[model samples]
Target: MNLAARVITELFQPTVTVALLLLFSPAVEPGFPGTAWFGAVAVLFVCVLPLAAVVLLVRLGKVTDHHVSDRRQRAPVLAMAAVSLLAGLCLLLAIDAPRSVIAMMLATVGGVAVLAVISLFWKISGHAGSIAFATAVAVLTLGAPWSPVLLLIPAVCWSRVVLRAHTVAQVVAGAVVGGGVTTLLWWLLLELTVRRA
Candidate 1:
């Protein structure tokens, strides 16, 4: 890979997307309501813990890279991630957290569920999928103020292609799955919450 692609891949990894979106939750309308610890619990369970476990796995040779670059190794990792994500979702839901946080968690569950299923047959671009989803959330939640972040999707896609981590088709598929699922989940959550009240 060339220097630019390497830089892009390193800079825009899936971990960055998770961290950025969670942190950015605060600037939008009604942010993540409740106590300040709400954000802490969210950041810890939803992002940090699973990420740390993955990093430890890499260090212990349970996986190859942060991306889980090997197709064969993806399923177990993704399955575990989905469980962690689901657990976090349950926690947030139990607390009666902000609607947006609950909605985002539901979207994440949707994305991971899709990834887990796809991993059985092919290696898809988790990096592209996640960043696209995060970008979509930013745009939907914060409107025009968050438009610039949408650019990250293509940049990350290019990096994945350039690094040979994914083909154009795979990355595109990932983007579609991530963006489509999250958008649907976000809209559905909002609409359903309105109905329940």
Candidate 2:
């Protein structure tokens, strides 16, 4: 892979999902003590623990790549990640965190569920899907001013192709699924919680 593609792939690795959620998470709010704690929990549960699970799967010979490059190995890892995300969602709800945070987090979990089902028959590019979802959520939460981030979707799709990790069709499917599903869920939840009278 060329350095540019490699760089883009690295920058948008699945880890970014966690980081972006934390960045946009309600934890940034100043007044709520619970919000700050929820942020920490988000990092630990959404990012740190799930990443540790990936590492453990690698070390245990259960997965062939850091990215779970082998399609066959993805189900167990994705299922575990989904469960972890659901747990994080529950924790946020139990603490009465804002609906936006909960919605974004659910979108993340929902993405994994969608990916898991698709992985059973196809090797969709997780990187492509994740970037698509992230871009959509960032724009949805931050408004049209943040729309430029959508450019990353094509960039990531190209990187996956360049690296030979996924084909053009797989990348395309991932972008559609990731962007479509996440955008729908997030918009619905945010609309219900924020926009509706």
Candidate 3:
């Protein structure tokens, strides 16, 4: 049970989830010029670089674990990730990435910022939040066909709890913040893009 929970947590960690989402963006909006490059840039800054920071910090003993389960150690990590995210966003804009990809990145930035702020005093389940955000975005972009992804939210939340990483309230809050904020932001961005087009 413990191993299964850990496996799920690691598999759907934020960096992995974000990487998959970006890599899959091309499929969502086909034929956009430089679509593959957009995903590569996003994965580099938002996923690769941030993940490197965490691994380095863990090696340096600044972070107790790769997951950064210690809330006290999360700020610097989140800050580093935010820098990477902002850099990615800027580069994506400069390169004229597709509107759908840009919208997804923007929503990602917002979600990370919110989670960073919330992690200050509370140990939120980042696992739950990340999976929920990914699921929400999948549903929003892929429509009813992808609605089934919603099941991932509770599954991830349960994994977090089973591992004793977070309380029920913390996981629930993570899901709400992750799903709600990203959903609203992604939806609004897509709507605005449509309106302008």
Q: Which numbered prediction scores highest in TM-score against the true structure? A: 3
- TM-score per candidate, in order? 0.87, 0.90, 0.93
* lDDT minimum window of 10 residues, candidate 3: 26-35
For candidate 3, list the clashing residue pairs, or say none.
none
Q: Which stretches of candidate 1 lie over 4 Å from their true place?
A: 26-36, 194-197
Give lDDT: candidate 3, residue 18.
79
Error in Å for residue 76 of model 2: 0.3
Clashes of each: 0, 0, 0
- Judging by lDDT, tell me the better candidate of 1 and 3: 3
Ranking by lDDT: 3, 2, 1
Model 2: per-residue lDDT, tens digit, 1-197?
Answer: 58999899888987776566665667334455556556666667677787899998899988887788899989998888887888887888898877667767776777778989999999998898888878877776678999999999999999989988999999999989866886787778767764562
lDDT of 1 by residue, 1-197 (tens): 57898898888777677666655543433533434355556667667877888899999999998888998989888888888888877888798766555666676778778887998898888888888888887787778898999898888899989888899998898888866786677668766763354
- Model 3, 89-129: lDDT tens per residue? 89888988877778778888888888888999998777887
lDDT of each: 0.76, 0.79, 0.83
Query: TM-score-based ranking, best first?
Result: 3, 2, 1
